[model samples]
Target: MSALLELRNVSRSFGGIHAIRNVSLTLQPGQIVGLIGPNGAGKSTLVNIITGVHPATSGTIVHKGERIDRLKPFQISARGIARTFQVVQPFPSMTVIQNVMAGAMFAANIRSMDEARSVAMEHLTFTGLAAMADRPAEQLTLANRKRLELAKSLAMNPHILMLDEVNAGLNTSEVEQALDLIRAIAARGISIVIIEHLLKVVTGLCSRIIVLHHGELIADDPAADVIKDPRVIEAYLGSKFAQRQMVRHG
Candidate 1:
């Protein structure tokens, strides 16, 4: 099967500073891929590039055989690419259901308010936020806010979902719940790219892992192999520790 999304030698620079350099990867259908890196490793920048928040300075992004490197963010969303921010930015005054309805109406192109509401309700229920649908978005707890973000993304009817730090602030049990929800999403055949800092979360939830460091792609492999890679180790723990491991092993 063709890839759901492909990035070819993609690079993005802000003036003289490179945020991402020569990174290329693919997201296959129904796969959950983990993107892990140290702070300032360009993980978020890479997501932004894919979502068109920041367009790539070079290289091409193809989704389902169409080049999308030049498309506007809304255009990208209309094509079934959706993403949630690291920071949840819901419309605070809107009801939870209304916030999701916006996504349905705008990105999914639902023309009627009633139709959007119906679609949004399905996603809210799927994300476990149906009980809170009538509440103002600002009234939610952090975990619920995250769920709201997920529901809104689902309302867009996405083919590919890139979740940036979706598990960031949750406690252990809450994270587990989020993982289950994510798995259910993948079961529907949506390709998922998760940007996470938690090694355990990444390893347990994703079949494949991609590592980035200092604006470059360093490792892309299965979870088991990626965790053992010296470059991935150095990216997380510094060169001295990586050297010590190599010496101790050999």
Candidate 2:
């Protein structure tokens, strides 16, 4: 099957420094893939390029077989690609539901406020923010705010949802809850690209994984095998991690 999203030889540079270089990736329909690396690894930069937050310095980004590299952010979003930020940025003045309603408004079919509200409520309920839907976005706890972020993105009716550090600040139970929610989302046939620092989360949630280091693509394989890759260990997961793994298995 054709890839839902494709990045070909994609690179982005700031001044003389390359933040991403010669990176190519593909996301298949209904697949949940992990994009992982340490800080400064250009994961966000690649997401920005895909979402059109910034233009690529050199290469092509295709979504649903159409070229979107030159498109505007909203244009790309309109075409069914949505993303949640690493830093939650809810509309402080809006109620939790209202913040989600704003995202629902992006759907071309959601013409009336009533329709948007209904759509928003479904996403809010799905994300477990239904109980707090009436509260101001700023009043939510870190975990709730993150749920709100997911709800808002879900409101967009995206085909490919890219989540940037969705589990960043959650407690263990909350992380498990988020994992279940993400699995539900993927079960509904939406392709997901998760950018996470938590290797366990990636290992648990993703079937395929992509690893980046020093702004370059270093590995892409099944989650189990990728973690054992020497290049990945050298670049991010150090030797001590492997030693612990060996001890556990042996």
Candidate 3:
């Protein structure tokens, strides 16, 4: 399968500090790829560059064989790319259904509001938000907020779903819910790039994982290999990632 999203030699800098340096990755249809690293690892920077939230200082972004490096954020969204923020921002005043209506609007540009609502409704139902459709976004718990974010992104009908730390502050059960939700999302045929520090999620969901440290990709391999990479070990998780390894087997 061909890549639905591709980054070629992409680099960005802020205040003379290289945030991301010559980073490149690909997402194929129906695949789940993980981006994992320590804090300030340029994961978000790369995500911003791809989603057009931050322009690349150099290099190219290609989606569906078309160059989209110069596209604006909305343009990028329109081109079959959608993302969830590490911090979700729902239209708090709006009902759950209404917040989803915003994503439905993406399809509405080429369709109709009625059609969009119908579609958005389906996404909400798919993401387990149907029962709360009448509730305000602000009224949701953290896990539901994460689910709502997933619903919102899905509402755009994106072919590629980019999730930024969707499992940050939840209980074990909540995290499992998130993990299951992501599996269902990918099962629905959307490719995904999950940027997470949660090793369990990465190991569980992604077939492949990329490790980055200090703005550089230090490891890109099968999820298993990436987890065991010594350089990756020293770079991000310190002695703990490896120690965890020993405990898992020992």
* Candidate 2 C-alpha lDDT tens digits along 4-49: 8889999999999999999998899999999999899999988999
lDDT of 1: 0.94
Off by over 4 Å in 2: 245-250
Which candidate tops TM-score? 2
Local distance difference test values of all predictions, in order:
0.94, 0.92, 0.87
Model 1 C-alpha lDDT per residue in residues 1-250, reported as the tens digit of each score: 8988999999999999999999999988999999999999999999999999999999999999999999999999999999999999999999999999999998997999999989999999999899988999999999999999999999999989999999998999999999999999999999899999888998999999999999999999999899779788977757876778678777
Model 1: residues >4 Å from true position, as ranges?
237-250
Question: Clashing pairs in model 3?
Answer: none
**Steric clash count of candidate 2:** 0
Which candidate gets the maximum lDDT versus the true structure?
1
Model 3: how far is 155 from its true place, Å?
Answer: 0.9
TM-score: the better of candidates 1 and 3: 1
The lDDT, on a scale of 0 to 1, for candidate 3 is: 0.87
- RMSD (Cα, Å) of model 3: 1.8
Pairing residues by index, what is the TM-score of model 1? 0.95
